[model samples]
Target chain A: MKWLAASALLFAASAVAAAGGGTRTNDDAIVGDGFAPVLSAYGFFSDAQAQRPAAGVTPYRLQTPLWSDGAEKQRFVYVPGGKQARSRGAGLLDLPVGSALIKSFRFGGRLIETRVLLHRAGGWIALPYLWNADQSEARLVLAGARVDLTTPAGAAISYAVPNKNQCKECHGAAGQVVPIGPKARNLSAEWLAAFKRAGKLDAVPAVARRVPLWEDRAAVPVADAARGYLDANCAHCHNPDGAASNSGLTLTWEETDPVKLGVGKRPVAAGRGSGDLQFDVVPGDPDHSILAYRMASLEGGISMPELGRASLDPAGQAIIRGWIAGMR
Target chain B: MKMTTALIVAASALALAGPLHAKTIDVPAGNNAQSRLQEALITAQPGDVVQLGAGRFALSDGLSLDAGGVTVRGAGMDATVLDFSAQKGAGEGLLVTASDVTLRDFAVENTHGDGIKSKGANNVIYYRIRVTWTGGPKETNGAYGIYPVSSSNVLIDGCKVSGASDAGIYVGQSVAITVRYNYVEQSVAGIEIENSRDALVTGNLVTRNTGGILVFDLPNLPVMGGGNTLIEGNMVIDNDTPNFAPKGNIVASVPRGTGIMVMANDGVTVLGNTLANHGTAQVMVVAYPKAFTDARYNPYPRNIALGYNTYVGGGDAPGFPGGAQLAKAFGGTLPPVIWDGLGGPKALLPSADVKVLNLNLPAQGAGVDQAKPALLSFTAPPMIAVPGNVGAPARLEERIVR
Candidate 1:
């Protein structure tokens, strides 16, 4: 500890850490219910500002990522030493009891907040750690924070960092907190195979139909691009076992029913989110659809994915509108 | 030996924590009240009281409570207020997802969505809480004021709500609902019990909304078949606000000045209510006037009983089309009781003393022009027996002062 303080890397506020994943991060935070006040206590990052991964931490990406006011996201998963994560079908990987997932949200290359999900013996716990102004450290904020930032499209917006309970609003299913991402269908097969070679995953589980990469959405089918976007962004809370299940509009990629996927479906309790639109999705007319209407709204009650977003994503709006317009 | 040591450690930890006893955690409104109040709620254990002190807590995000057997109390309805005029996130002001919880004596104002929503939280009580939009009735105001959905044994007593674009006190997909002694005004529909059953709505003063009281059953919901409700001893008056409900909502079809409208439900009894001064007919029973694809849904109102409800000076201007001409044809104002004459058990009706108009439509979804308006000749059946096992469980009333 004294030698590290004497070294120059300790005070590097914005500098990148040395490419040595030498030290294994702290393991006690993942196994216990104790709330570590500082993000450095978890030891998940060798350099907190540059977002470097420590030893036993593996970086991954989702095929279609949930957009957060155009913030860049860096994702990682860390299983305890000798704990192999099991995968089944296309569901979320069954990580061991002491596993943890880390994701940091960034805007203009400055780290805004890092969210961590620790799978303890009881269940998974979600914590939001807000980075300080100096880019040196982040602390756990149970109440979340609001940061004024400009989106990639140059729209100035007040970004909402979701609180702890809002985490379960997306990650929960069947009344229990669980992970929403890291499914075989969402993750790349190359990463799955490489992770199996590294002895982290038990096997490369078979996936029924993988979601098309978001980068190649325009080149792919319109429904694939549109439904994949919904699965990544809206389905987390719109599925049958989701927070918006009361709305009766399930947008999961696997949902094939037209009415269930908001085709000619009337809103249950949409209120002003309807935007005076009559149906959830009107074929050949995206402007008349409530689904596209809500996606384009920046108003509080009128917006879809009501939490974790404060700005409009033009790409998402265009994709959904195009898909709905293409429908016969 | 190792197991015995672990048991001993666990026992001692339980003794130290004492999770059985109820604890009171006070949260005063001050600097960083968002974090202070939200932290108190998230960390509150079962059987704990998260007491909010006397002041206005300006909140940015909606607060949530997911623990069972908890109580969130404020100093008083006027003393402590949770203001969400600057709210940035979440659909509702407060979301409770746990069972056996009690919320009382708090005012939630100007939320972006519903004021308080308890979803799938059974045996919940909302007593003396006030939810108001502050601004007058507008299309942009939040949908519901006090919304309890998909729960059982819900008791909403002595609450107040105003300026909701939708129903003020909306209980949906629930059973054993008791809504009593509530005051709702300037909302689209006051005191709506939708797609639910076994409800007792009494002693409520509903006024100045698009419609006063509504019992509706719609299609395509997870829960349906609303029936066996009692509406008695309420003052439903002067609900003449134009319909402010947004499009696509079922409430948008509610005509202005409707005293009590029952739609597509079975065994709904409206008794002993002083219904007065409306533009539409005082009591209207109709079917769901749309096409639905739900196989399990019944789109007809059935077995509706109107027992001795006092109707005074209404139907001067019917809200729907051709109402003035039809009333002129029938001498002056329309009758007090209006029926679409689509479906019925037919035995459940008002006595012959009450004036009635039967819109003998040919089929469902028929246009109002096709209506063969005629006087309903009623031979009254016996006084109906009230349904059993309605209202919230009697044990929940023990928590409130009234």
Candidate 2:
């Protein structure tokens, strides 16, 4: 009888936990709920959390994640301060859910173009549209609807970034799909929501919430840094099915895994001649290393990752250097 | 008849007693070059020559000469046909494992792999020879026409080759190899020298293939590209298309699509060659300094000379966003030096394949005429000499057959 009572209590607790621990607000869930309940509660908390003014009053700003065009349509470029909008061309971003995307902010001018993608369970797929930019006119093609919001309501509806669309192609595979890499792109919204429920969001800095590469040092290990750099730069051609497939050096994160691929072979004859490096990786010394030499060399014979935005990123190179330096 | 035979034997004895500077061996119709070669091996000793007649004669496979000082020559390439088509064996055609083996004016055809392979052999001279495969110019052909690896002091002169998926003429891990007066065409690579010490490539005509010429210092090899490798006075043009093997081959795979691709190589001298009409670039040099084992000791070649050569049709403009800029981005600078007095010139290895058409395509008409009256300049070799597309026209040639 006593055992039955104990078991019943345990079962009830587990059931409650399974039902989101009664922690997540109704709006926190992607399914079964709208944002009203959580929005009202958060609004109340914002009021209480507001601190009193000490000196000169500062301009108040409340940034929201929404799109003026509609909830179904995702905006590629959202200039928060300018409250401007842009759209990629047609058939660019019909991406599968959970795919990775990378966007580049090429121009320093007014309008910013961003590329979006989705990381699906199978592989990286592109969101078939692209954002084009001009001075005055902003439009979204294929999906039909161009909304440029310069007012407060417009800014409130724009999608919050540090989003995947900001750097989709920058880390894209093939043409514009976000392939798997040494680093993950963005933390899933569910994971972020889970952290919010666990009260870790306030502690996680804005910087930590940025892209995977820009996240706090705690997010990734040093050993994985080289893989991240290679993926961002060289994986396009060094894989099994790329133009450089004959070289036999698959720079993909999965193929380059030391134990599995045995990339340590001195000569990769299967590679033909491109990656016929003396050593794939030396325990110590990056300067004497062939991989490092290719990365550092500016010559056509040695420079690596063939083509893209041109020139190696100094910061990214340094990160890879550090990782190589760490290898014992 | 017996008296005539005795008089002939007496004359032979007298000839043997004379100062034997140039040795000679007679090869008749019934007895093949291999049998005569065996007899010559027994009698005349070192510094002897095996002279073969002009005839369609077949030979066995796996003939290696570990000893130095032997010469194998034929009356002419057309007359002395050595067909190894029937023998499907491993190894190369006419392999000289030792040094000082001189061969001239013989046609070696249908070799399973490298037609003429000399490994660790030095002071070898192959002159006026034709190394070929049975197939015609479609690429799916032979491995290498004249392949010399880890050898030294070699001279390849007046040879004609084609139909190789790899380099029609390849020299690797060697030093002091002079390649001149050879006609190579319609192969993966026309001439390739890799991981050698010091070499010279001059006065050759190479055209209408995948890549033009290449000097590479691959990793794990004992030697890198040699210092003072002079590539001069050659007509190298139209190394554009990919090397396709045996017309209907289902398994031969060659990575064509570039012209002159130089990767992981250093200290080369490229001078005075007419290059044209490439699928990708006129010249491409890809180096991997980080991947080098002894980067400090094995200094990356600081010198690459590209001068006084007519370059034609790489499908890119002359200036800024073209081949020159790409070269700088990769590590090479434009306006490479012309020449140095000794043998080779000085220049920088290109970092990327440069697309430049310094000359017009097809090489016909008065404006584009490359034919100089003096000695006809260059010759177009027959496609049967080189078979497959294992190598590029001017790059490293590799063929691995299971």
Q: Using lDDT, give the best candidate's number.
A: 1
Model 1 DockQ class: medium
lDDT of 1 by residue, B115-201 (tens): 999988899999999999999898988999999998999999999999999999999999999999999999999999999999999
lDDT of each: 0.87, 0.46
For candidate 2, write residues B1-402 as lDDT tens digits: 999999999988657634565546676545544545533443334656677777866765424444466677788877887787753333356656556677787888876555777766677777888977667654324567887776667778789887775678888777777788898877777888776656677788888766667766554343454545666677777665555543211112223434444444445555566666553455543333233234323423345544445666553322222344444443443222111111122224222222222221122112213312111111322121111221112211111011
Q: What TM-score, to 2 decimal places, does chain A of model 1 have?
A: 0.92
Clash counts for all predictions? 0, 96
Q: Candidate 1 i-RMS (Å)?
A: 1.1
Candidate 1 lDDT for residue A232: 91
What local lDDT does model 2 show for residue B121? 67
Each candidate's fnat, in order? 0.60, 0.00
Candidate 2 displacement at residue B5 in angstroms:
44
Provide TM-scores for the models.
0.93, 0.42
